[model samples]
Target chain A: MSRKYQAQIYVTLRPSVLDPAGVAVASGLKQLGYESVEGVRIGKYIELSLSAESEADAKTQLDRMCDQLLANPVIENYRFEIAELAASV
Target chain B: MSRKYQAQIYVTLRPSVLDPAGVAVASGLKQLGYESVEGVRIGKYIELSLSAESEADAKTQLDRMCDQLLANPVIENYRFEIAELAASV
Candidate 1:
């Protein structure tokens, strides 16, 4: 039997990379009177739902998904959390 | 003394809203041979650093930031986690 899993993945730029979009958002917040926002960095958050035979299998597939399509490993780092949703009938 | 806080914010499309970007990504994944990807939803992940008098103050500021600039309340939902970094000297 296969289990349903939900994966929440976060892909962030490496600290060494410049994030112009984040800088723009920070400035926008400041202009809108959010003076306390000192800095901001923006990234991608993705949710994926899938079915796998086991937790390890789900994780392996998720890892490959991130590496192959979800993230650009050169300048971005990706991490994910997988939660079991249900046992598929 | 004021404290430094780091905020991680996730902003996702409301369930009722159609996510064309997610649909595109799902098809892209399929083309890349990730046939197991049943569904995909894309969102925004933001990291913020700021100084606040207390945790409560930080939370309040973060909420306002999200409402005012970080997220569109009509079509998106946002949530955030805050971690205390250090006390200002």
Candidate 2:
């Protein structure tokens, strides 16, 4: 039988890519008197749940999902942590 | 001397709040044939670097930053992980 799993995926822009949005936020923070803040980068965080026969199966599917849709491989990198969920009562 | 620290912050909508953007993404994924996907919630992932005297100091500052700017208290919640960086030459 299949088991439930939850994945916390983080998608970030490659370091070489410029993040204007992050810069804007940094400036905003500076204006608010948070002068110590530096080098801010913003990205996408996705929480997804699915079911698979095993942990290996879930990981393989998640990797495919990230490569195909969750992240733009050309300019973004993605990583995720997966954990099996307790079976529902 | 102060040391560098990195903070990974995740901001997500409260469960009771509607997530239209997440719904759109889930539907998009479904169209792409990932039918097993469920409870897809999209959130903001932010990476920030700063200098602080210690880990506790960094954590305190990050908490204030999130409260004031990074997350909305009304509809969203935020949590973070902090790592101390080696001193630069």
Candidate 3:
């Protein structure tokens, strides 16, 4: 039997890493007359649907997925939330 | 006087938009031996810091920011949460 799960992953550049997109956005805001825009950081939000046998199994698999390709460990950090997919009658 | 506020903005593609990056990620997960990946959607997570007079002001400003530049209104929809920045001390 297979159980469904949903995962939301957030991948963000490490604080030490320079984020050009963030810089660009900040400047864009400034240009748009948002003088109070103090800072901005851009990150990736990924929503994934998976079928697994158990919550632990789903988490383990998702973690491996994040490490292998979904996120670049060297330059970014990733965090995720997993929830059982509600059964659709 | 200015009060600091933090806003977390989530920008997601509309249902009708074709997400090439999402397709690529789903396929990549499949190739990585996770065949249970039913679907994937990619979006943007942005963290913003601003100084405003009140929460209402913060929400208004943030809404305008999203409308004007943070997100592409044509293809993407954005939602945000704003909280007053606690005084450091």
Candidate 4:
């Protein structure tokens, strides 16, 4: 049977980029009675499951995907994790 | 004793808003050998702990915060959850 892999990617704007969403969420928290909330930044989490021959191959594919499509090198950055799944008992 | 509240806010770009970060992450996953992965979008999760008199008040404050800071009304949207904590067990 082919091995299954799971990848979780987190993408966020570089610190220099302006994030209006982060600002708004922080303001909303304060209004919701969370006065102590501060310095909120927004990012994305993506989870994917795939079939691969090995962990090394999976990592290579994920890296290429990030470079070609998942992240914009001009303004954003991304990180991903790939894990192999064991067959169900 | 004052009530403690936990709020988690998720922020995302509106459907119409262009997300370069989302695109990058999707591509990254594919490179990592996840050929089946599709339609990846990115967002933010914010966790906050606050003291409030009541759930209603916490909700009100959180709403205001979202409106004022946590989210950018023009390009992004946000949603949050608030739960009260019980005394230490």
Candidate with best DockQ:
3
> Candidate 2 at residue B88, lDDT?
52
Which candidate achieves the best TM-score against the true structure? 1
Give the alpha carbon lDDT tens digit for every residue of B18-44 in model 4: 878767755765676556565555666
CA displacement after TM-score superposition, residue B62 of candidate 2 (Å): 1.0
User: What is each candidate's DockQ, to 2 decimals?
Assistant: 0.85, 0.82, 0.88, 0.26
Best-to-worst lDDT order: 1, 3, 2, 4
Show where candidate 2 strays beyond 4 Å. none
Q: Candidate 3's residue-wise lDDT over B19-79, tens digit each?
A: 9999999999999899989999999999899988778988998999999999999999999
Off by over 4 Å in 3: A87-89
Please write out the lDDT profile of model 2 over residues B1-89, one tens digit for every residue.
Answer: 88899999999999999999889888888888888788699999999998888889889899999999999989999999999878753
lDDT of 1 by residue, B1-89 (tens): 78999999999999899999999999998898777788899999999999899999999999998888899999999999999998885
- Which lDDT tens digits does candidate 2 get at residues A1-89? 77889999999999999999999999988898878787899999999998887889889989998999889999999999999886642
**DockQ of predicted candidate 1:** 0.85
The models' CA-based lDDT, in order, is 0.93, 0.90, 0.91, 0.70
Q: Of 2 and 4, which scores higher on TM-score?
A: 2
State which candidate, 2 or 3, has the greater TM-score: 3
Clashing pairs in 2: none
| Per-residue alpha-carbon lDDT of candidate 3 for residues A1-89, written as tens digits (9 for 90 to 100) | 78899999999999999989999999999999999889999999899999998889999999999999999999999999999976542
> Which docking class does model 2 fall in?
high
- Give DockQ: model 2: 0.82
